[model samples]
Target: MDSGIGSQPLQEETADLKAPIAEPSINLDNRIPGLDDPYEHALKPNGDPWAILLKPEMETDKIQCDAWKEEVQTLLIFAGLFSAVVTAFVIESYKFLQPDPNDAIVRLLTQIANGSNATSSPASTSFTATAPSLRINIFWFISLILSLATVLVGTIALQWLREHQAYPACSPKQTLALLRMRSESLEAWHIPQVFAALPLLLQSALVLFLAGLIDFTLPLGPKISIPIACIIGLILVFLACTTILPSFQPLFLLSGRFSRDSVPSPCAFKSPQSQL
Candidate 1:
């Protein structure tokens, strides 16, 4: 051969041109589809357990703060109401103690004089009775008005607090499912709450009315009857509350409902029966 221009041996050149091909190794662990995004592993259509837990924890803190504020307001309203009650008692007591314009003996004498001495009768037989002590009446009236105003204001405040935006006790992914759940199931428990409030309100009004009536009608010497009456009324109220409480237990237990997506939903405060 002519050596084809360059001077290397053919076998050496051929051997240098040949390169070995390496086989690719397969990874079993990395082959998994969701491995790159682990968060997808924790979520489901219904919701993740962790998210559910987080929802309640966050809402609880906010609920607790709201409830505490409501308690403070309730206390203030009660204090104002108490002050009003005391003022009413004082005003009524003073009015009772003050001399009455018409005495039984005076009335009897006046009647006789009017019948027998018609010609000599005083020019004006009319007795212009002074109005109940203006100062005391005004104080009692203002106290009552203020107390009522306080209750109204407190009620408005409570309503505003109730309206504050609340987050579901579950993750956002499951929020739709929670909303789909028939919250009407919760009606069973709410009836008792409504009825309970009614009775309590009635009892309060009755007690207040009785207290005022007793102060105005009964002399202080035999006031023990009022306490006894109040005790009886309280016993009735307690009985009613106890009866209603039992009815509420089942609703309270069912408060945690499963959403359509199977996530645990927020606890309902009122029982289902109340919904009716």
Candidate 2:
């Protein structure tokens, strides 16, 4: 009887407390009311996702994206210059791949003179490739090709970045929503990752060129080639050290990345914010 009385008070307390209401679920498919007809931004050809952005986040992301774009431009510039330099080397190196007619004639003459007294026939005047020449030419050609490819990819990436900056919005109030959509789209499509890879391609081209240069100098005697080889070796070691330093110390890679101005937090995130 005592237990039943205690349980009756607990049941009464439970009945007095009202059930908690559920939070409304987000509905992305529904068109936002009072906005212009271009509400379905995600489905359009130049689609931007419907964005819910905090103003501060939008501003900060803009700064980071802008900095990243500038970096790509700089990379393109360097790639162009490097490609020209590689082309110059390529022009010189490619000639060695083919047999020189003058050299064939010289060999013929030397053979005829040496066989003047012998009754045996002279050797055939066919060209043969030397190991060092073949290796150097192959290395340099690949390097030149890689550098040119970098320039080409850089150009395409820059164009994509340019096209992405514009937001598709019919009304001025929808500006913030559109901006956030475009920013999200950029990240979703992996544009930043593309920018990151450009440097790696350029670096590969540089390494190949250095290897080819080493092969080219090695043919000369120890007196001349030794000094050149040592200097190049030192350069390779320095580049390797600098490249690896970033893995050990990440701050070195991220230094000076931020812009001088602070990113202003204009407002908090809202679906279709009034002002962009």
Best candidate per TM-score, number?
A: 2
Off by over 4 Å in 2: 1-58, 107-124, 246-276
Candidate 2 has which clashing residue pairs, if any?
176-276
Error of 1 at 146 (Å): 0.7
lDDT of 2 by residue, 87-163 (tens): 88888877787778687567667767866634444455667778888898888888888888878888898788667
For model 2, state the Cα shift of residue 25 in Å: 22
Q: What are the TM-scores, per candidate, against the unseen true structure?
A: 0.32, 0.62
lDDT of 1 by residue, 44-85 (tens): 788556557647744664665465456547645674666566
lDDT of 1 at 186: 24
| lDDT values for all models | 0.51, 0.71
Q: What is the Å distance of residue 5 in model 2 from its true position?
A: 41
Worst 10 residues of 1 by lDDT: 177-186
